[model samples]
Target: MLVVFDLLYREYCRARLAEMQKLLLLAGESAKPSKEGHGAADQSHDEKDSLQQRGWHAAD
Candidate 1:
């Protein structure tokens, strides 16, 4: 019984570790800066367009 419980606990820990590693990898990838020269400008333009389409107006 003890051995079975220990094995299950280890498996659970391994699964949790794998999930954390995946999350870290995704976070690292997202934190990387874009390689394209105009990426930021393009993203900003798209965001502004989306907001305007949703009836969001800039404050004067």
Candidate 2:
């Protein structure tokens, strides 16, 4: 049950991130900084590290 809940939460987060990205793009008329690393706070540290390498630094 716990594992299933985690999976569902991640999926929900991903979907919300997608929506936010679309909104930002439409508002700016251009791509936002990080196309793939939406919702970095909810993502794993390793994923965030990769994003950092790509020039993203999470808020401290």
Candidate 3:
């Protein structure tokens, strides 16, 4: 039972870490201006919209 719990906990931590990394990447992307001269805010909005279209939610 303890081994099983440990495995489950490890899996949960791994998944959480992956989610956090994704959120951090999105945040970093949102903070940068687009190469095409677009503002960071506009770029962020576009990214969020794209994520929403794909059924993914951006961190608030």
Top lDDT prediction, candidate number: 1
TM-score of each: 0.58, 0.48, 0.55
Error of 3 at 46 (Å): 25
User: Compared with the true structure, what per-residue lDDT tens digits does model 2 show for residues 1-60?
Assistant: 999999999999999999999998798876445557556564677686788877744444
Model 1 residue pairs with clashes: none
Q: Write the per-residue lDDT of candidate 1 for residues 1-60, one digit (tens) a residue.
A: 999999999999999999999999999999997767768788899899998877745543
Select the stronger candidate by TM-score from 1 and 2: 1
Give candidate 2's TM-score: 0.48
Ten residues in sequence with the least summed lDDT for candidate 2: 31-40
Please, what is the whole-model Cα lDDT of each candidate in the order they appear? Answer: 0.90, 0.80, 0.89
Candidate 3 per-residue C-alpha lDDT over 1-60 given as tens digits, one digit per residue, 9 for 90 to 100: 999999999999999999999999999999996578678898799999898877744343
Candidate 2 segments exceeding 4 Å error: 30-60
10 in model 1: Cα distance from truth in Å?
0.3
What local lDDT does model 1 show for residue 4? 100
Q: In candidate 3, which residue pairs get closer than 3 Å at backbone N, Cα or C atoms, i.e. clash?
A: none
Each candidate's number of clashing pairs is 0, 0, 0
Error of 1 at 46 (Å): 24
